[model samples]
Target: MSVDGDPVSETPTIKEGTWEAIALASAVMLIVWMFIAAGWIILAGEIELAQKRTAVAAAFVTAGAAVVTFCTVIWRGKINERQTNTARDQLRATEEANWAKLLQDGAALVFDSQTGKQSAGLASLEAVVQTQHRLFAKQAMNLIADYLEQVHPTDHRSPLAIAAIDALGSGHSLGFQAARSLKFEGPNKDNKRFAPRSIWVPILGVRLVRYYGGRMDTQYPHFNEACRHSTFEKVYFSKASIKDMSDFESCFFRNCKIEEIGYMIQENTFQSCDFSGAVNFGIESIDDMPDLRPRNNFYWSDRPPIGVTEIDWASRIISVPSQFSNVFAGERLMTKEGRDFIADEVLNLQRHSN
Candidate 1:
């Protein structure tokens, strides 16, 4: 610039420190640029490494979740099996305990029976039967019947015997065998210690004896002898095969129903004995020789008679015949006309005898 013009020499005189200050500024800027480039490169490498580590961690987490799911399924199955086995064992143990208790109770009942405690024994037997153990109840019934027939023959009319009879009646099939062996006879003459006894036991469903091809008397020997002067209250003989009933006399029958008795009953006294359903003997003419009069002797009655009164058929003024209103009330074998005819015959006989 000074060589071109006249003011070149004056302009060529430089500023005091302008060139040095510019060089210093350029150096400082170059060092700053280098540092920035180096930092950017390091940061880029670190971000790439972090992304790889994150993918590896994600893979590990997914594998771990699958393992946990499989282990949980297996563990639950094992637990359920263990619980099922435990419940089965408990049920088996309970059944065993129940069986043991039943055996123990049966033994105890036998002991009571053998120790002369018949009332207590029968009560225990009844309790066992009420438990609905059919086999055990049947066995117990058989044992009691055998005991009564073999050991307690002379123990008729005892409260224990009565209870045993009631127990026997409650059974279905086992009672029949026991009832057959029962001896309902007058007392033995050799054993004067025993009173002149009758069968005070209340018999129910005696018609079942017919199934064994025999009448009640044939099945139970001396039954007629026991029936004499004995009160048979609420006895049922429905559809029974009674061939010969000639010995049924001097007995009191209350609310007894007879269906198909295979005989012409002529001598038996009926006191509320219902023959309306008696198909065989309903039309048979009853004989008057054996005193076919209603025996009012009873152990218990709804309408209890006053005092020790005997029903006298000799007098025309008599208590109303129980058979007229109760037994023969409906359309049965003994019609109203038949009843009237029989009554007139009885009155005529009474007058002739007097």
Candidate 2:
């Protein structure tokens, strides 16, 4: 203890204070506090009733401290207490390490074995996801995606798989920030986002995928690097929850029933997709409505939704080539400022004669 009441040092780190030093400090503090109380009580003695009451209170406190000091010495003095704490910490570390191993070896438990331990593995994976640490939780999420994709192509998944899929898709288990790191594919099979580290896994990252009819009864499924090149047709999104940050690029979607979706489909393109089945479309625009992702084009096959239908279709906020103006004039969601951008701007597709 120094003259100043700053108990903690300025540059304090976890590795501060040896157990011996800490114990000594505690004992010194205890003694000093007790002495001050005793001195105060004596100095105020034989005075006013308030002073007498204060002295009695001080006496009680000193007695309590004496009891505590005795107990400390008998039941594992400071050294023993410190040792017990160290042991407890070590135990916790061991448990964490074990869980992390289960996280890393998740595929074996999930994909491998017939002892009904597959469910156990999924449970372990969920455990890792619960922690939501970028290291283990991200990998756990990636594994969860792998398991879902393995069963996604087909209509049915084991109850265990469905449960796991929902836990992940809903993003209820992994929290907000971690859920955004999720990916269906990457730039190449060999990479992940710069924030977290991951290895190449099938369905982890791919450029293009053309999905045919399949019942995608899942939650919050997203494709990363393959958005533009992926195509989904006759896919039924049953109970599927599309989050706010989702993106769908030039990929064609036909006869797809998007049962439930809440997202920002920005300067993205939708040429011949039916919007009748799409539900829960979010009202907030990702950008300032007409700024970023400027190359947006919407050509819905059905009547557009409310927020989208209100787009200033006739407003030409930005100038575009007169010929291109004729190309997008009929689009229900196109705004004038949005008109300045064209499909070929991002997709690099050659423009066809209007």
What's the C-alpha lDDT at position 43 in model 1? 57
lDDT of 1 at 119: 58
In order, the Cα lDDT scores of the candidates are 0.42, 0.45
Give the number of colliding residue pairs in candidate 2. 7
Best by TM-score: 1
Model 2 Cα shift for residue 176 (angstroms): 6.8
Per-residue lDDT of candidate 1, residues 1-354 (tens digit): 421122334546323244344444544544564465455445556778656655655565555555555555555555576689699769756754564465456445645635455556666665555544445555566666655555455434566666665666655334332324344333432332222233333343232211111112223433433343233212223222233343343332333443333333443334434333233333222222134332321111122222223322223112334444434456333346445645665566668779
Output the TM-score of candidate 2.
0.38
Q: 35-89, model 2: which lDDT tens digit per residue?
A: 7766776676576954876767777667767755655554445556668879976
lDDT of 2 at 50: 46
